[model samples]
Target: MSETSPAQRRPSGELEASVLAALWAADGPLSPAEVQSALGGRLARTTVTTILTRLHDKGAASRSRAGRGFAYSPIQDSAGLTARRMRSELDKQDDRNTALARFVSQLTSEDEQLLRTLLDAADDTPQRPGTGPQAAP
Candidate 1:
């Protein structure tokens, strides 16, 4: 059997990301066939369906019946998804404060300042009871 070429092989998670991107760009949920077409000819409809199923299983995407096939949509926008992933990684650490400090330390000065500004703004904003990261506990 011939091996797949490097160009044909995708980096791990790239396909799922592509599928999610397509869903995010679309105005509404997309069927597997629609996702495959939106991704061009690189992925098969079955593969798209599998990716959508995996995403749904992980709660990254939501699905509903669209004719005989299912339509899928991203549960969160791209930035929201990335933030959730970051929070998840941070939550997994034994020493979360140290993990966060290290992460903050590595940020560019501009990003650091932006973070500070965002934090300050958050402090001023009226927060609803037991909402947001600060209220997790």
Candidate 2:
């Protein structure tokens, strides 16, 4: 992975995913200045602007002219974005089920038992009420 820049680093040095997260969680569009104010960080206004423009270019945000500034809204809300990202990651895995199985197998005994219990519970759970099985006619 490429080194994260100061402008893109979170309080914990992770990439600035939370900034995009915040904008996506907001109820309406926001200018870069508004984003900066909402972030309440040491980041320069330009840094926030750069991040927002990058998001727009990546198709993550929609931008519209608002007088001299551009108002940006998240193209996908936070939940949608998270689902998209999760699906994308799963797609990139060669064998997602196998990976999960290996991870579960490698867990401590207690954790492994917990995983088995959870899987058993899931297997015992019934399908949705209106879907799948129905009573015999």
Candidate whose TM-score is highest: 1
TM-score of 1: 0.87
Residues 15-125 of candidate 2 have per-residue lDDT tens digits of: 247568668667888888888777775567788888888878877788999999899988887678776866777788999998767766789999888878987897688
The residue pairs found clashing in candidate 1 are: none
Residue-level lDDT tens digits of model 1 in 6-122: 778878998888999999999998899889899885776778889999999988999999898889989999999999899989989999989999999899999999999999999
lDDT of each: 0.89, 0.76
Q: Give the CA lDDT, 0 to 100, for residue 127 in model 1.
A: 88
Output the TM-score of candidate 2.
0.53
Which window of ten consecutive residues has the lowest lDDT sum in model 2? 9-18
Which candidate has the highest lDDT of all? 1
Candidate 2 local distance difference test against the native: 0.76
Q: Report the Cα lDDT for residue 114, model 2.
A: 83
